[model samples]
Target: MRLFLVSQLLLVFISVLALTRAQTAPPTTTDTATTETSTAQPTPTDTATTTQAIAIATTTAWTAPPIFYPFGSAAGDTEQFENGGDTYRDVAFSTPFMFFGRMYNNTYVNNNGLLTFNQPLPEAHPYPFPTHGSEDFIAPLWTELDDIGIGRYSYQQYTNGSVLTRASQEINQYFPHKGFSASWVFVATWDYVQTSDVNVLNLHSAPAITFQVVLISGGGYSFILMNYGDCAATYYPVEAGYDTISSTDYHVIHYAFDGSYIPNLKNTSNVNVPGRWAFLVNNGTETENVIGVQLKLSSFLDLTLNENIEDVLQKIKQELVNRGASSFFEMKLRNVETDKEKNVAGRETFELITLT
Candidate 1:
């Protein structure tokens, strides 16, 4: 009877163990949704070969937008450029298939091709976003779009009262030099979060006049923009920045805005309001939209694209002492090496505003 009892007990224990396992086991999912979520993120792609830099500074005046639409059925069709530009197609592609590099596919080269900026923004933007190199800009804390280089976000917009056309407090271009104009675009996006008395967007902060500049390869970038700064930054000159992405990359930029043109304006004007500027070191993500801040641009009569990105970086280092951070600045260079190469992007210039 004891042996029989022992065998029965053993069987009971095995049964209980099997029941527990079954209860705790995870269910096998065969649905497509489950499969997609399980492996949604893409692995990092190999670094691309360093591209040759292009110089856009022609002596002739640029009557047309830097990019030309390759194909179209009408003259008024609307399209967004790769580098965050919304446009109203003024004239169709009249120039010989000219091109410029922009946030991935700034132009709709595909028109019907199915392979441009073809990924979701989350997957397309750079990961580990370069929030680490805040010190370079001189600000202990960095704001949005600080070092964002050019990507394929800009497109053509052909509307009358869209965000690209309306809401510009000022869309003044500068003739920093005789032969060239500070040709940059400044668009107003949504408001950003801030806690300053400066009253951005009449009250809110950040996302002030989203802007961008072009690189050596003709890609648009955001190097300078408006911001909601700290106590010290809110007053006098204002809190602004120029990150390493634009400072280090690119050949030349025509920072469209200039506060000095209007004397005695720092106390009231947005141009003079931005005083302290900083540069954030590259975070090493080659392909991502960047953030930006406001800056005081210097009057450059003949700024040209730099031949070497390193030289441009070194010049910026020197300017920290020469120009200092007192509002008022200027930069002219082109080309950014990809993470595959340390290069990247813009201008009032919002090049990369990546606040998602």
Candidate 2:
């Protein structure tokens, strides 16, 4: 009985040990699986953090602002104008004639047609009409009226048998003693007058006449006019691109007047004045029109025209590399002056810098 009891106790101890070992082994497997899942999750987190860093880098890149320079003065300077007189006529008839007036009274017309108060009339002409016939007699009077001042001039003529009646407009001054002067002259006539009708009914009228005088400096002048009424808007088409330093990615792009390229002067055609440069931006697959800024010609030539064109391209490549944009982005230089062949000083090549 004692032996049997001792054997039973040993068996019981062995069974308890086996049970404990089985429980401990499952926990080891569970711990290993949990560690593997934690490691795998951290890898995704690292990838997400990397993506966020890239986004931040791209957003912070510097882009240049648009710059605009007007032809005459700094942007937003008010234009000046001056008015001299109204109607004072020594009447005549027949022939086309020009009216003259004092801008700065008693002023002389400079080589540029600018008037200085102390100078003499620079140019003179016999009134536009001849001093002959019934119509010719009245022409000088109209010329005299035009020379008296700066303003729009209108004339009317009436005839009864051989008698002709004439009238002209008086000057209405708005801008006084300003730097600019302008004038307009209109002439019209009828073929004949009826025996009893004082009112001229049938008349053939010429187009209205208009002219302007802009004094730039002491001797500079600009005379402008629009003879015809029909005017149309101007348009320009442009293509641009950039290339990588290693000649990796070269992109070619085009834009129309009404498309992505927005010009500063929307109403007029590009004048292509000397010393003007433009900047363009990438708008996804389509690039924005060369409208971001107007870099001065001096600045562009200084920055872009040094050394060989190829060398400049390499410099652009270096810039990309310094910015840490080497692996994924590239630029190819495209020719920008081809469309402006007449304005090109020489056969210079333009480069396109593209990002891949």
Candidate 3:
């Protein structure tokens, strides 16, 4: 009877120990997974909560504020340079500006309302953009502008925190989805600049053109903002836009090509804000037009009808393809006559071709 009693106690103790171990030990992988799946199943309340979170995130969209910057003596900032007629001042950039694919560490700020890289364009007169010109330039009112006597022009560059923040915010508002942050900004203002023709023609009165060109760059991206303020009508040919070397990329502002409609620039805008135009110019794949590509080809290739014409056509086709042109597009050569010797300074006079 004692032996049987001892055996029963031992069995009871072993069972108790097993129960304790089972209670204290970590669960097996399969058991843990089963428990999680059972409890973690989505309820209607969880679905509603997730949907609400997504809605809240989507509702918080960002919008850019006003597009204006301070300038002149009253603004108590900016570096003023000597003003002249048809002359340009070589200004070194605090940071290099990447344009198209070229990097420029300096620029020639011309008095006639333009910024030219590679060389200075001191001509008092203005020409239409996509001139197929060799020099790459940015014109905010490229005319015979004179700030020598009556007007003031100044520039300021920013690497400061506040200005960088403002630049980032303004660019984000204009070109969204890039999540851009501006590391450098250069602001050039042509305040109350008068037309050079006024003095030459001896006019009793002339209109004053006020505008600003702001360069914002960061993270291999570059942008330009042309801001107009109270641009009055002028009798000079004013071209407002930018052109790349070989005319690969160019944009001409509406009404700016004709001199008579100069005042319209003050109220017109590309971003819905009056007197403002913004453009992304560093990698200009998005801004380049089909016409620009044709011009680019004209600048390089001698599109003469020769025995190797087939090879020339194939070369042109391949060039277009290399530049992201669709294979299904149509191209037509217009006015390829031999008498059309309008090619001057690498600018072909005859319309080489049109791409559609």
lDDT against the true structure, each candidate: 0.26, 0.27, 0.68
Using lDDT, give the best candidate's number.
3
**Could you give me the TM-score of model 3 versus the true structure?**
0.57
Poorest stretch of ten by lDDT in candidate 3: 196-205
- By TM-score, the best candidate is 3
lDDT of 2 by residue, 1-356 (tens): 99999999999999999999888875578898998888775578889999999987655622111211121112222222212232123224322222111132122222211122332322322222111222101110111212322222222222221111111111112112323222222222111111122121111122111211211111121111111111111132222222222233322222233212322222221112211111111111233234122111211342345344544554555455334332224344444443235445543335364544
Error (Å) of candidate 2 at residue 226 is 21
Candidate 1 per-residue lDDT, tens place, 123-238, comes to 12121212233211211111222122111212233222343222122222211111211122221111112233323323323322222211111112222222222211211121
TM-score of each: 0.23, 0.19, 0.57
Q: Write the per-residue lDDT of candidate 3 for residues 196-224, one digit (tens) a residue.
A: 44242222144556788999999888988
Candidate 1 global CA lDDT score: 0.26
Runs off by more than 4 Å, candidate 2: 29-58, 61-356
lDDT of 2 at 78: 25
Model 2 lDDT, full chain set:
0.27
